[model samples]
Target chain A: MAAHNTVATSNARKQVAAGGWLWGAVRRNGAGYLFLAPWLIGFFCLTLGPALVSLYLSFTNYDLLTTPEFVGMQNYVRMATADPKFIASIRVTLLYVALSVPLKLAFALAVAMVLNRGMRGLPFYRAIFYLPSLLGTSVAIAVLWRQLFAADGMVNSLLAQFGVEGPSWISNPNYSLYTLVVLSVWQFGSPMIIFLAGLRQIPVDMYEAASLDGASPARQFFRITLPLLSPVIFFNVVIQTIEAFKAFTPAFIISGGSGGPINSTLFYTLYLYQEAFSYFRMGYASALAWVLVVLIAVFTAFSFLTTKYWVHYDD
Target chain B: MTDAVHEVPGRASTHPRLTGTVRHVLLIAISFVMIYPILWMLSGSLRPADELFGGDAGLMPSQVTLQAYSDGWFGLQVTFGRFFANSLIIAVLATVGNVLAASLVAFAFARLKFSGQKFWFALMLGTLMLPYHVTLIPQYVMFRSLGWVNTWWPLILPKYFAVDAFFIFLMVQFFRGIPRELDDAARMDGCSPWRIYRKIILPLSMPVLATAAIFSFIWTWEDFFGPLIYISEMSQYTVQLGLRSFIDSSGTSSWNELFAMSLLSLVPIFLIFLFFQRLLIEGIATTGMKR
Candidate 1:
């Protein structure tokens, strides 16, 4: 009986010791936890919780009005086999990502190189270039783009002076997507700024040395500038690609939220917006969203994996 | 030849004066092309509707008028004034929340020692890359269930939680640059962590905070997706939604009025850019270089 009493007291003591350790931890790092509380709450409640629920919702049939009913892989199957618009959206988005990212980066790099030449009034030039990027995604800019590309609008008026008739670029299925691409290219300012910063990091002596060696300007650019700038180029490519994939506002406004002109401007995000909001196909939209997430993840991972081949580091 | 060589070290092949002239001319032409569209839009807003199209594509308006401005101001069912007010309220609230919450989180990561700090920081950075579409549906459903579909709460509340990981990341980078000795000295004065944060860190961090605030305000003001998805009522419409509605409700008839309102919508962003250009450039350079 006495031995049993000792054991009981020891177990109670152990429990108290464990509780003391926890409380001690709380006291030691209490301020840190307090500072982190808001982000912690946001992370779990808004980010992680919603992501998990979205994953579940992707497999179900749900409208806002009805309780979700599980439908297995039906939505994914339909997207692959039955839905031609899904196929078209994927094609258009892929084409857009392929065209706009490279074109924008090239234009940005070309302009950045020119601006990096220690010119007079550089800030004025830089700000002018950047203004469009700041305003690009706004509804007003998209509205302006629609009018500018109309058959009877400013673009055609200019074209008429040159004796060339121009089609309404915004309404032509053959040319509609290209207008959005041009719009994306026009906002090359942010990336150009980034490229300028990267260019400044490259030492000037290298260029001088190349000049001494009688390397042609073009040759020097290919050998010296391209290699040194690869990492920045890589960063720009990944960022711009992701942004292009998610391009919505311009497409929505320019197409009048129809993604029409024979669905030529059917960006993946716009289509997803239509499904979820317009058609009330929440489940299908959730599936589409997951596909986009997977595409982005894979692309990011692919970029990282291939970085060793091209992306240089000072280290 | 000797004088030419002495004038410019590397460019012995061409006259420096000629090259300089060419470069300046090129830059001026590029600048004009870059700004021509905006100039045209501005001019279009001032011109009479009949004179807006099928004319010489010129920057000057034959007759300047404020008719479009007045018409656009009262064009829609709800006036542009109401939309501007709604946008202002949402943007201001969002900016305040982002700056305050992100700064607090950044301070903890930069200064405080704790277990799993590295883990939590990594998670925060991971969310920076995760596409928002993955979470959009569930968040919409959550807000709808709470009956926040037609309210500004859905747009404004997530900001308070520091869901904008970019701002937190930006502040963290800025905070780490600050000397740790200041924090240690503050602690020696028997100052609480919160007090040190308030007194020592925040005052020195005005530039970063301002950068974050400016960006947050601009992004929120320009956000069409959140407002588009959540607020359906014309009364609660943001400027972006209002602008979109103008296109739909008025069709193609009020092109001048549409241009007028569109230009007005850009005025606030333009002002912010004008005043805070240095901060914006530095913010972009610093965050981008560190990445």
Candidate 2:
């Protein structure tokens, strides 16, 4: 019996030692990697691997049907030097992005403030405002945008009421880009929702304190709300910037997929889509894609680096 | 906020500002303006093909008929039923797939202990930063090579691989908010990891999962680009792509039919938002918090 007890004690001690060693390894390395697996697998298969291939393909003159011929740097040179449509698309896209992002942020912030005003049926108003954002990039809205923007459509006819003439907003090169920008801004719901969330996180007592101090509402807002809300604003700005840069559907649908009226509304991605799918310039399209990625990354990094001056996260 | 905490309280009310009545009127006016376009589209859908332009425009249709709706639903070549079904199938499957795969991966990331997790996380996040067009052609080639073009495989398969890292990251942040004590207690009760996940985590995760599902549904339903690129066969067209066919590229387009079809197609999504708006808002609001 004594001998058996001794053996059991030894076995138990060994087991504890092994467990300790395993736990040490887990504490050192296991948790983060374990949590990372899904993203890792997804990144490798869906992003990294595909990105590498896209880089390689940018140098090859491969349409879907033919074997990829090594074209070296011809695609890049042509896009940089020879492509008129490429330049037009870039100019249009930059204008669209610049207008859309700031306008969207402003509109979203305004709506967020209005909704925050202790109103009855706040949820309903929010839901209503958010509907466009949910449906904005959609074909239905794009289709509706086309219908409403067409000559003799609802908008122009409404304008006709005031003895004002409205052009063919979707068909006219001069105004179609505005229609796209309007479409982009209408989808301000996502940012508004984010702003609302950020607003809620601000301590209400600060506003009350301001009220007690006789601070005007505007003063309270600029002094208290804006600074505190800056982090969320920063987040929204970066996100909306990227989203604007990637805007494709409304341009594609509203312009009837030709980016027509002389490619006035041909956004970067829409142009990329045309190059790859419509013109079969797969190599050039790939190069365009890399450029877009670089542009987005640079912008995002810039936002992060500059955030130190404004963004306030309560640790 | 820090400054607001120290404000002088007495002077706020003395300042002339938007009084209650004026504020109310202004809000109502703005609301009407905001809603006018949607209202106009709705009414436009009801106007008959010829009367859409021939008559003076009115807010309400003179001859209120379901003809346009019927035509949109029962019309030849691109019937609403098939498109609706296609949309429904695509939305539901993609939503289900995204929520399930995202949640599982989120679980592994939030709870499990593995190796090289930060590097993998950074890589996953890096995917979000990549312009989707960067991968567009390569993905197309991959699908073409697999002969998955003209099929739902292209639309659905990548999602299963956790193609959307944003949602995964969102779910992981949500899952981490859960108390680890529950998992420890379940382990003490001899529950396997899968059993714990099925029984406890999923139930607790209902709100976020709904958010993911709703978001995925809307995104997939709205995604015309994918359908436009991958599905060439008319029979396989999703609602968004199918609607595009109504617009003739050659000459004058059918404005009435297009408006009618556009309104009809928007109904399902609008209905969904109307029903689930609170859930959507709460979902977006609560997601990504350190909880």
Candidate 3:
């Protein structure tokens, strides 16, 4: 764009640089693509190529020990009709995502609102709250989560002080998914920080005007804060939803990689891993992967579709 | 509780000071819940076996000792020293690879006019949402076929090709914020596009590059699944896999030792976060999504 004022069109100039032919056009962006070569190689060989291969693999019966044998949709059909574990993993993942995202976002926004009140030691509190999200997904943290949710672990010990007995959180099927949800909500720092940034962007005068009009704090939140903060909320929802869908390590580590307690903690990625590697069901895993992609695509489509009804951007 | 105190009959108050006090107290309590587990680990790592499972969930150990630290460091066959070097090597290389490749590609995306720009950008972003498991087996097979399994190559190479689209996207957002006037000025002085990028754009981007570097190092250091699937040799394990091995070998008896090593594993990332906190937080905050 440096030469933009001198030339009417940079594209025409770029075309002319390599002698004005289709080959010239191809050669023109060579430097740009050269800068992009690593990503381009990765995009093809790593992402899109394997993505297509996985799609093909989904339709075949391939164990790592043998060359893929064409199966023609049997994997998907089995997943839909016969594979109980696959169905269980999907149910677990949906429940986890549905429960975790809203809870995390709500906790995040509430704390963000509190931190936005100009308290002392703002950075200190923000950092402390954010510390969990930083380390939450680590194998160590997941292992600690296992211990914390054990029958005689700290969670139950604390519950005992209140004169109440607690169930074994991780080993109990009815309670296992909820423990993961609590873990998800515990790492509310990323969205909380983002919400803090958004909260700061909202003009002080908007609140002042509402206050002058005699709006209660709750009223002002609905009238002014919700509308202004909707875009940030939307971003957090989409990202966290995708993240919750992809959660693996906690369930893997907590369940000791068997997705047990009767498959209570069988997250989708964990199940896919078990299929591909543990059971050597590579074909089945690939099909499960594609099904997940479609599920996420539907959710993402819903997010975008619902935006017009609620999300408002002044720009 | 403080709200009731604010309703005193005689004194007229206007600062909203009472609510602020209540807010601070509530925030402090919540922050305790957020931070207590980490502190518990720190304390539990120091305590003897008898005190660890006791009903008291205090952040202070009854008997403070560095015995667990020494035991954990030397407990594994390969030693924590080996794990440390392996983690540092992988993290440093991956950081270098990601910063170089992401910056170059980000420059092209942000500054240069290219064909199919929209499609390529979308493709890169689309990769961000792509479940890594979709590409997991094929990549494993590809790397295994190349004889790179059980080594660092599979873990570190894709990073060189900007496989982590998040870093490139972050850098692109940073590069976009640089004024085009700077590029124009550099060009007027007979600079080529590469020279302009090197002289002007690169100088203005240290914060973002640092942000990317810190994130890369932490993530690579913390990565478990990549090494779990690829690196199987005992001597080649990173710190994360080493910690997992600790648990696998002695499930319940080595709680104090596991806690000690886990805390030690977190130190590198914690220190990096401590030093570069502002850049990383502001990077994510200002990196197009929030703004």
Candidate 4:
């Protein structure tokens, strides 16, 4: 690894040295860095550098006002053993991701298929559906979600029409998280749009051939559509899984930032926020952030590893 | 000077009319499902709080009034106007910065060849996977140390620096997609590289620029986390942060007023989207599936 790193570094250096008149060319390419400079500066100052700093901070005890004191692996150890909320948060997050991802993808695929059928005013339908996904995870919609799921809100009144009294979805612990799941599923537009595009990319001739083969609609979908769409499905899965794990706004708005009604809706990021800002447990939150990174990386790696068997990239 | 066009289809139609009718019906049904929530939200906003949840039968408002709108605009904590202004300023600034900065970087990435070009590009791509949460606390701490909190600096400054690699990457792809022949032709006509970019490339990239502008505007306007962490001063709050504060405060929420405000929040986004919905959808859908 060291030898490879050195070789790559030396090769880079030699290229730099050999390019004497290439300075003009280098400056042009360097201008790209200039365009990218602000982002690079931000990455170092705001994101990347901070990420490394946070990892270090996780091994220390630090609040905003005071200097950080090195505490070794105590934060991690304590979180693993003593933190009940930590454990509960993990369960809640996994459940949220697991429920939200498949439902969102399925809904998106179904809707995309519906829209793919040579619909009139296709743009209008696409905009309307995609609007929610664009605005869905926002604090405004989360606020709207709270009102829509309140005890005497629109949902309960609709339920009353069926003579099935509905619980206050956001306020009630039993149903609060379910409202969030519904919220996630509602924003299925982004993936739906992608699926629609992917569907369009699939040759119409193939479907025509399937029909000629006397294949039923269901049979054609199962054999042809499913196999071809596997890559898109896998892409949506990875992206949605990452997104769901980071979901914070809804739980915050619905539970009033307490992660309340017995911590049923305490998502991992919310818990992390509570630790960092609310409880002043910056070290713990830092540790939690790192853990989330690991979790996401591991899952992402696992998906990539398994993609050879499942994901059908045409190329 | 009149030209007449005529179509002659002489029994060449093969697809069934029943299939077309069935497809239309399915489409209408699908559209209804998509539109219902937004329609519900809109209708609900026009009613009084009590009437909003009155029943399924009264889904439409009985006395559609501007009371909620006025109350939303003036009476409440996040009195719509200030938040709107804040959101507008942030969004416009972010859009301007992204367009100017991302375009320059994208030009470099697409057109320029230099040492470590591939490595730098890969680095940018690699950084895309680093979730914002990992950097949230430390950024807060860093900003706090610099006393940049309770201000828009944390939100706005980072954006100017091209912190959003997504936009950079998006613009890069767009820039790459443009024909290189235009640059060569411009150069042959004695244009500088900068002149080539400004005169030729930029003019042709209007659609992509518009796409980027719309996205940056919406994303910045809707952003919650950055503002939430950085801005503690109620007066300094962006629209999203202000809206959140409304939910955070107890006993202050008039459901009708909140819904009305929510609707108001969506107006600019809605209008922008309506005007460019086709382009936005196509742009997002195509770019998304590419990866």
Best candidate, DockQ: 1
Chain B alone, TM-score, model 2: 0.89
Model 1 agreement with the true structure over B25-73: per-residue lDDT tens digits: 8878988988898898899999887773765588888999999999999
True contacts kept of each: 0.66, 0.56, 0.49, 0.56
lDDT of 3 by residue, B1-291 (tens): 877665542222444577678888998999888888778888888988666474656677878998889989998899988999999999999999999989988998998877988889998988888878888888887888898989999889899999999999999988998999998888789887788778899989998899889888888988888998888888999998998888888786878888889899999878977998887678667752321
lDDT of 2 at A81: 95
| Candidate 4 per-residue lDDT over residues A1-315, each given as its tens digit | 999999999998889877854776665566556555666676678777899999999998888778888999999999899999999899889999999899989988987886785667777677777888777666778877777787877678878988988887777778888889998988888898889988887898898788766688899889889889998888889888888888888898888888878899999999999899888888878999999999999999999999999788887
Please estimate how well model 2 matches the true structure, expressed as its whole-model Cα lDDT.
Answer: 0.79
Scored against the true structure, residue A215 in model 2 reaches a CA lDDT of 81
What is the C-alpha lDDT profile of model 1 across A16-37, one tens digit per residue? 9999999999988899999999
Candidate 3 per-residue lDDT, tens place, A4-95, comes to: 76675666687676566667666668768878888999899988898899889999998887899999989989999998998899999999
lDDT of 1: 0.91
Q: Provide the overall lDDT of each model, using Cα atoms, as 2-decimal numbers.
A: 0.91, 0.79, 0.86, 0.79
Which 10-residue window of candidate 1 chain B scores lowest in summed lDDT?
A: B7-16
lDDT of 4 by residue, B36-121 (tens): 76677777778875653545524578878888778767754546678888889988988898887778777777876656778878
Give the number of the best model, judged by TM-score.
1
Task: Give the clashing residue pairs of candidate 3, or none.
Answer: none
For model 1, what is the alpha-carbon lDDT of residue A47? 97
Question: Which candidate number has the best lDDT?
Answer: 1
Where does candidate 2 stray beyond 4 Å?
A1-41, A211-214, A313-315, B1-18, B54-57, B249-253, B288-291
